[model samples]
Target: MEFKDYYKILAIDEKANASVIKASYRKLARKYHPDVSKEENAEAQFKEVGEAYAVLKDPEKRAEYDLLRAQGTYRSAGGSYQPPPDWQSSHAGNRTHSQRTDENFSDFFDSIFGAHGSDFRQAEDFQRSTNRRGRDLHYKIALFLEEAFVGCQRQIALRVSEPDQNGSIKQRDKTLNVKIPAGVTEGQHIRLTGQGELGIGGGKAGDLLLEIEFAPHPYFTVDGMNILLTLPVTCWEAALGSTVEVPTLRGKVKLKIPQAANSGNKLRIKGKGLISKGGEISGDQIVTLQVSLPKERSSEAKALYRQLAECESHFNPRQAFER
Candidate 1:
């Protein structure tokens, strides 16, 4: 695994606060969203960004990461600092020994952090006394909006490393059958017991925390549990109240537009948003109205517009701005 510079990826100062880290993550995530970005290796870059954020976003992890980085404790293949005999034994007692290994990191990260391996025996010993379960591993799984509305099952592949008979570490692939419950919201986590890193000694294995992320829909954006959609309506539809068919995560629904409704008006559909886990709590869908004008106007249309203009000659739309 290569060393990762979390501050560099976020383009923030070392003293950046949690809010700054969160803002940076949002900006970077939007830019590298797989559905929209065409950048080379965008997916890889995005993953790297996520990893960086995952560490920096948490105060405890960030502090530990900063300490290790400052100590120059990491040893890369070509680094001048060499570990002493049984270096693992020296730091074996450190709580962050496993984290320092960076085994889960990429080669690029390993190059920076230095290639280190965890001492399974030491970890096992530590667990024998504490009897504490291992920390849960978190992963983000992206789904479509429809999938959020209708539950689905997904087969997920995970890579794990284990010690071989010779004590060398080997990578293994594990497939998990995950059931996505309906009404699952983005940022929510599903816990799978004994699916994370194995516990040391006889302790219980860690739980796998799978965070939900929704794919960007072409027509809608989600906020909290509410769904937002910018629906284009004809001028007549806005001037004359009409019931229009609108698309939702479930299906098409009829929405009533009040007469004289203007562009940018928002209409709410109650209990039409994402359902809660227990199928009891619900949210709303907000539809923003947009009035589209005809690109090409007929002669009669121009005449009618001129006639309307004569009646509204005194109306100065920009008067407020001028004042």
Candidate 2:
């Protein structure tokens, strides 16, 4: 539980607004997105950026975090300090000041902020008589393609901090049930009120913002509501045209392929894609046809090919390429 200075990560003051935080995060994330970055420790730096944005992007969490910092309890790990008794008990059962997992933070943070119990307790005392709004918390949720299409419920586990009589910090785990609505898109946000950081002075509790992301599927790629799939068809199937069974987010459906259909031909399934939130509109699933050739050929097959090649000598497929 080392102390994390999010302000330093974003190169901004504690007074920076949501826009500033988002701008800084985007700039940094692009520089360290792993796919394009060659810098050493880029991934670590990226994680830190995300963590900072998670707290600073929301007003409630920012306020609560600032409040804790105002108290002597919040300090860098390098600083030497100890907590007094009754600090943890005061902030018990408050979720806004929840402790991040030790795995997510650096060892330096653990050595410094590991004892969050006292900090939270001090925060409680500071707000004992004040009117404060609850803090907003951020959560990242992974969804399957089917879940994203049809909607689903999920159980999420979170770790938080609790205090002891001696003002020592201890880690605790809590589980929550979350309902994911159908047709949820990646990067879309779902808000759950009163599930965020606790408000000070008996004020209203904050909200929890869950950001949606879909797990990679072997067969499909999703872009907004559109579903893209590359379906492999046999040569005969493409040449003769046939009804093929295709898989969608919902289930399998038959697709009619017209005769003489070429490779790379696209077929659309209307209203069979993702559903839009709070709207009756649905996206279309685009299926691209790919022709696969047999790798092995028997002697009879080769003789038949030779006969066909002799009969089709008038057709030169590469005349355009030669020209």
Candidate 3:
């Protein structure tokens, strides 16, 4: 079997401190976790990361691995992998660290640290008495801004660890219809109780926290609970105020632009952005007006533009810079 470089897999330097290693592991785990990640081959990548962390986190295991690497028993990323003599002769670690990689770990790792090796009895005995509370799960879900304005239900499948019939915790998949509440903003969390890992020794199951993120909209921008929209208008429409139809989450509404409105002019429509659960207006939608000029004009229009330019020739737009 080809050797696995735990350091390279974790994206950490060989001499990375424990804290840095842990941070890198957590970040990668979140990215590749099967429940939340839609990335290509995420499940496989997640398993690789887990195996790497399993070996690297333990100092004793790391020391043995370092020795194998130094003695040419192991390999680096994409390097030729060859075992040193007497690999299974019990000179290296003897399965001292037992964190559930027995069957899943690659043959390369198993050769260096034999499965159920010399000191396996102590680790097994220690595991018998270790009962841990269910671990809480964190995940992120994306929604359109309109969905945040109007509450929606989503069927999401969660991958969790639960107690099996054999009394051992194993990965289990569960699907839930989650109700996303209205006014849920970006980075806000929705907690689902009793939806996490199965309890040990009859302990209560932990909770699952779902974080909300908004998908990018083509014509809208978000600020807190408020929505911003840019309305493109003709130069004449901006100079001479016009009533225009503006788009909102609910529907299009009529907005009156004041005469002589310049670019970047913002008009607020109260109670038109989002609504809170208490039936209160969360925020208003702000429309920024942008005046646009036609690129081409007919002969009559060009003549009219020339006349208009002559009429306003005395007005110097660069008056601010004249100072």
Best by TM-score: 3
Better of 1 and 3 by TM-score: 3
How displaced is residue 286 in candidate 3, in Å?
A: 1.1
Worst 10 residues of 1 by lDDT: 119-128
Badly placed stretches (over 4 Å) of model 2 are: 1-130, 161-171
TM-score between model 3 and native: 0.58
Per residue, candidate 2 scores C-alpha lDDT tens digits across 1-323 of 44567889978988777777776765666455443456678767766765566557656556655656677564637674434343332223432335635434444333433524444344334323333455687889999889987789999876644332222335667678999998789999999998875443235667888999889898999877889999988877887889989999878999998887878899999987888877587889999998887899899988987897898799886899987
**lDDT computed for candidate 1:** 0.71
What does candidate 1's lDDT look like per residue over 210-279, in tens digits?
9999998999999888999999998888988899999998789999999988899999999889898888
Residue lDDT tens for model 3, 145-174 = 889888899888889886543344468788
Judging by TM-score, tell me the better candidate of 1 and 2: 1
Please estimate how well model 3 matches the true structure, expressed as its whole-model Cα lDDT. Answer: 0.75
Better of 2 and 3 by TM-score: 3
Q: Each candidate's root-mean-square deviation in Å?
A: 19.7, 19.2, 15.9
Query: Which scores greater on lDDT, model 1 or model 3?
Result: 3
Residue-pair clash count for candidate 3: 0
